[model samples]
Target chain A: MSDALPGPTLSDEPILRVEDLKVHFPITKGIVIQRKVATVKAVDGVSFTIRRGETLGLVGESGSGKSTTGLAVLRMLTPTAGRIVFEGQDIAPHRGAELLAVRRRMQMVYQDPYGSLNPRMTIRSIVGEPLAVHGLDGDKKATREKVAALIASVGLLPDMADRYPHEFSGGQRQRIGIARSLALEPSLLIADEPVSALDVSIQAQVINLFMDLQERLGLTYLFIAHDLAVVRHISTRIAVMYLGRIVEIADRDDLYRNPLHPYTEALMAAVPVADPEVEARRPRAVISGEVPSALRPPPGCSFHTRCPRAMAVCKTEQPFLRKISPERAVACHLHTS
Target chain B: MTRPLLEVNNLTTRFRTERGTVAAVDGVSFQVAPGETLAIVGESGSGKSVTALSVLRLIPNPPGRIESGEILFDGVNLVKLDDPGIRAVRGNKIAMIFQEPMSSLNPALTVGLQVAEPINVHRGTPWAKAYEAATELIGRVRIADAASRLNSYPHQYSGGMRQRVMIAMALACAPRLIIADEPTTALDVTVQAQILDLLKEVTRETGSSLILITHDLGVVARYADRVAVMYGGRIVEVAPARDLYARPQHPYTLGLMASVPRLDGGGGRRLMPIEGQPPDLASLPPGCSFGPRCRSIIPQCRTERPELIQVADRHAKACFANV
Candidate 1:
């Protein structure tokens, strides 16, 4: 049993740690000898950590780099600069066989269930492909049993494995996607807006399924979404991004109750509560203006342009992500000074 | 009481498909008083958007048509109007703001020209006067430097700005009724708040009745004076916004409210999601549309469809269960 696990294994070590991660997409001109005109800093200097079995939600609107950060962590998109340490190993520079071995422990669940599944393959084949690809397909009967168990884990019937993707509903398709991602038995899952495409009534079912899977499997998650309410439901801690930079990161309940950054406050206030009484009692402090382009983000603090409480310093000097409390970090001049 | 600004009675809209004639909006009825905001809330294939298109007669004739209904606007039945009569009403008395602003506006034309064209056609105003009016309309929707932006194309403007231009065109003639179908769904949350606030403000100033069709329960709670919950092409429940949120009568409404995770609902609360898939409009069930999904389903619900009946003042529900 001890031979199966040979390394300096620490119980308190984070399952994943991302430090100063930057994913800049270059805009070039000309077809031949293209010259870089500008750089879109999609994920700039973002940092966070996820303990084993904890869900860290990354939330932001369009062009905020929430999706880019998730991709960079998975190495699907190369990071311009940073460290993505998974289980104490910096796999940022790994490639080919090294990267493939590391990727076996990390999986990503996409946002669009309709486009993610293969139309030509059956549900059993789609879920079992990963097992076969990793040389785990020992025999026909064993592989079929494994696929059936995975399908049943997501609350879908085992017999549905023979059906195609199009035959199932949107919610059922999303469950199948989850089942396929879990086939590898990865320790960390990066779910990017996994339930946004489903119907309102079905979104809750998927969310509950995610929580259930996490508890039963002891899986860590990096949940990226734009909806604050949905993020709050499943996250242990949250990181709020704006203009490709993380403006605030705190515990789930603390962040919602007392948001330090102006952008965080504005984002929360903008989400209309379902209860009319709560809506009436809440303040109408909707921040004006749209998100600035990532190619030319506002100088100093990226959110200063739309910050309701922006001061002179916020426009000229950048704010660093500094720890204010044990479980909170904020990038705002108002709190720094 | 004063007559409703727009009254739709038993409006049934169907589309001819390869499978069969599918009733997209089945016997739906609702009303909107002057200056009031009525939000029709439903998910995809619930017929909320079809009802809005039916009101304006924008449904394509070959594949889609209004089978039977009475759309009365200021005492005149719009469903019975001739082609030219309907054209006169459109943009002059009732204007529609579509969900996608990029597709709705022409890229070849300037913002000023598009906004002013309705004024030119409806009232036959001179080009100079119409341009001036268009500038005012754009400014009313909170677009800065409206005169300067008139020459800008739709491609030059951002998504939020493009939507503002769509709203300006809808208000060019000061239409009595404005039907906006998910106007802010494409924009971000903060931008969505700004757009909805501007819409409410401009409509209030003009005293125009607004029919907002959307699937977001949160948006409906904040902006709607009255709400009509739709399911499987029928109006399952109707009530004042406050009452509906306070006490949702229908089982579907109750399930929907419970399913959504609220911003203020703290953390760790388990969501009670309604079981079963959304109804298939092509092959709907025999009786109640929500019977299979209802938590408190009664025997009568599976045998016969229920009609919306007034259970309280301004509150109605179409369910046989005592929920």
Candidate 2:
């Protein structure tokens, strides 16, 4: 069934292009003056691009800067340094009203359904907030009708517009969130672990909904998640991140079939298989030690300390993101040469 | 064949809410043999966690109660045991690892103290001796620099490391059975695999039975000897790991299997998602809880609750049509 779909081809012009993105939160200590102790480098020197109608899956362990990168792209958090060119325009330099205008074309669906949705707001207000904020429609009746239609489009009942978030189940709430993201008819959608909070059975539903929406609306996606299985299901291209930087990026099949980066290999090895025979046959490369603190990321490759194939060069020389194959890019010293 | 270490027979747990008493675990039955891993696979509200919590009598009283069933551990009925008896068995004979290690471990206490507390509480060993044993257990779980890490608080440890600490604490007393409830849900794939491997290796070394409560079918195939598919508070299907995945008898089980995206599966294809949502526990339907979502559901399934009947040797499914 999957073979019928065309392979994801790279476009000459990307809808969103990010270069050397960095987001650092200041850390302070002591009571007297609150001196700066250090910085938590959530995202550092990460570069990627999302073409129109393309789904780019950003995968990594927790604190891998995937979510931070997403936020930085959306300009939710002011980046310390980077370029975010959306639709051939540098949107990073924009501020206030200018940034708001750019945001109309880009939308984000958050991770937590329980927390993201406002308890005070009904489904009508929650989904219509974007429309209200943008002042798209004047009449409340017209907005409510549009919201209802959007809800129905996402497989939710139109009558649910009157209900609160608490009344809906986790999966239903996520659909509502998706509907809210789609309310503005944005070209780019950044879904940060959109289906992570959902059940396995329901996750597939949400994922398929996203695909269906993409096909129908011609929307692009920056899908962020830690689950490789899920990323494999929805994404065309995948970018592997580790502690503040993208370690590898490639076509979904290329990355899964022949992952070059050590971290990528380790991540793939860690995914549990549902088939007993397949699991038994696969040789697992269990990386030793825990992911180091993002506050004090390793001196060189952030994953060097935990990398099974770590060498002296890995500790001193921070590898640059270089194209290993035409479609595959990796940042390990082994592939740098 | 060896006798099973833990046997759960017709276990049914209920929770009294403002709406009504909802049966969270309805007549669920499964057994875990010594040194074997039994996985309970289900989505949220499927009662997989509740079933595990019932074994330890950890279900919140007043609101939640085990209405009926027998939890037989080492030939002793845990359900019948008094507070002290259950307490005695909780950490010493049966240990548990919660879903979120960050919340499960004490934020105030150091990792060493938290892990050692189990040993001290159950065995009454000296604090110093218990602390030493805790450090050893930490090392056993593959937490590097165990001595230095022991002094660190739960907040100081990473998610994966904290989970390792939780595992260490659970194994502190060398319990006969360990009930891990979604222990790897909060962890990354790499960390989750490491934790699973550690669990499997530790359990194998100690000859302890493991009840891994999780929704991930992949984890079950990798580590579990037996798999029990739960839905709407009932065991819809239970079979050997390989057999269940290859030929799932229950429609719900098959749906779950098909829904999960395989690593080897081709790209760009939409996953075969289960049509509808999981049933609401508060207002469950008359017959089968999964009838609304089941593709193969019949009129009989909607009208009558199916009994878990043996479909094969040591394999049972709670479905009329599939069997």
Candidate 3:
């Protein structure tokens, strides 16, 4: 692996390490020659590490930049600053075939299964494409067997491999996508809202498939989603993002039981409980107004405008992540180091 | 209970799909009392939306038709009402708020004009007088700058604000029944909370019956007085919100409750997902539609259809379980 900077040795390296990552899209103003006027800091100075064989769930509302951060970590989008050290190498500056080589061990499963897969391609070829791309298609017979196994692993029949993408249900389509990701046997997978599009029953099936795959393959995952319950179900650790920054990150149980950040508190409260009696009794703290415009985010704490516990310091100076405990980190002034 | 504001009896709506004639909403019956909130919970293709549309007499013809039903709104059959009679009831006494506010509201017109429409059509009030009422209604829904917002188009409002405008329109003439179809589904979670809070407060204050059609079980649990669980275009179970959650009778209902991951702060068990896909409506089985996926399925279930039988006071389930 080519290193943008000399990273730590492989023996000591976490599976994935993101430090001060920033993904800023330049807003251009021009008809013909576009000039950069300003930048939308979709992901600003976010950092986290996913150890091997563990699932780190990245969760937030829309425009929270969880998806952008996922894309940036995959090196699909170039980051403006910071380091994305995968294994023993910094992937920030990787480009061309070097990046593709690095990506062979890291894969992404998209949200929209219907749009992500080629409608014209057969399920066999769809899953087998990664093998062909990685030049493992010399033995066609062996490749076909591998594709069949992956398809069956995702709970789809090998017989359905020859069928087109449109022939299956939404849940089935998502399974095909997951199977394709497994074709490379990637050690790390970035699944972007994998089951949110699926029905409740089907969603459970797919979510279980992910959990099963993780255990069987020992694959680490960066699971990005907006649903809190689903995240907590599968994730070992959960990171709550608010306006391009991580507001909180803790063990899944700890995060749910006691959230330190006010934004995290509101995000958790906003989720309606499935049990009527419990929901009726629970007092919900409703966060006023929509997420502030990401184009012109607030100076101090991006959330202070709508935050219920906003203080005078919250309006002027930014509060970065501070470790409240050995395992828990919160980005709120209330939780002083 | 004040002679239940609305009662639907054996309502069956069929659609002319590419495959063939399919019963989208088959033999569904329920009642909504005055000041009651009934949540119809189901996934996509479950006919929850069709049921709501059927009650309002808004089923699109040619491809869609209400084959049989008695939608009794104040002792009058809405199914029997003509175009003009139903139009008087539609958006007049029984208003609807759609899932997509952008699509529902005319983008070309100002927010005020669109909201004032019900008052003008129903009350026969002048545009100016109706606009004033619309402004008041908008204010009631807690949309800030309600007066100035009247002049703004639908595009100017945020998703949450547009939903607020939609809610304001629903409350234009103090309608006896308001049917909100996924009213907050398009908004973010925080915004969704705000809209749900606003809708509940307004509905409770006005004492109007609300029929909320949504795929979200969580929303149903929080706001619904009663819940009707629909599956494969049929009402599998209907019970008080608490009763249904506490003790789900039908297999499909139980499976649904188990399938969802509860955020109750005490859970590590794997979700026991229902094994099979929802049956296609057009090629539904002879007897119980859920028979293929049911855990407690018996031989008799595949041969005989079960009618909804009362299990307890105000609780009923249409299943052959322990009968």
The candidate that achieves the highest DockQ relative to the unseen native structure: 1
Candidate 3 lDDT, B273-300, residue by residue in tens: 9987877998999889989998898888
Candidate 3 yields a Cα-based lDDT of: 0.90
Preferred candidate (DockQ higher): 1 or 3: 1
**Model 2: per-residue lDDT, tens digit, A1-337?**
1111222244467788887888999999998889998999898888887878889999988889999899888889899888888988987778999888888999999999899999999998899999989988799788878988998999987778899999998889999889998888889999999998888888888889999999999999999998898898899899999999888999999899999999999888888877999999999889887678898888878788998888999898888787666566788898765
List TM-scores for all candidates, in order: 0.98, 0.95, 0.97
Ranking by DockQ: 1, 2, 3
TM-score (chain A only) of candidate 3: 0.96
lDDT of 1 by residue, B290-309 (tens): 99998898889888999999
- Superposed Cα deviation of residue B47, candidate 2 (Å): 0.9
Best-to-worst TM-score order = 1, 3, 2
Please list all clashing residue pairs in model 3, or write none if there are none. Answer: none
Query: Comparing to the true complex, what docking class would candidate 1 get?
Result: high
| Candidate 2 lDDT score at position B164 | 87
Query: Which residue runs of candidate 3 sit more than 4 Å off their true CA positions?
Result: A1-12, B265-267
After superposing candidate 2 on the true structure, give the runs of residues whose Cα lies further than 4 Å from its correct spot: A1-11, A29-35, A139-144
lDDT of each: 0.91, 0.88, 0.90
Ranking by lDDT: 1, 3, 2
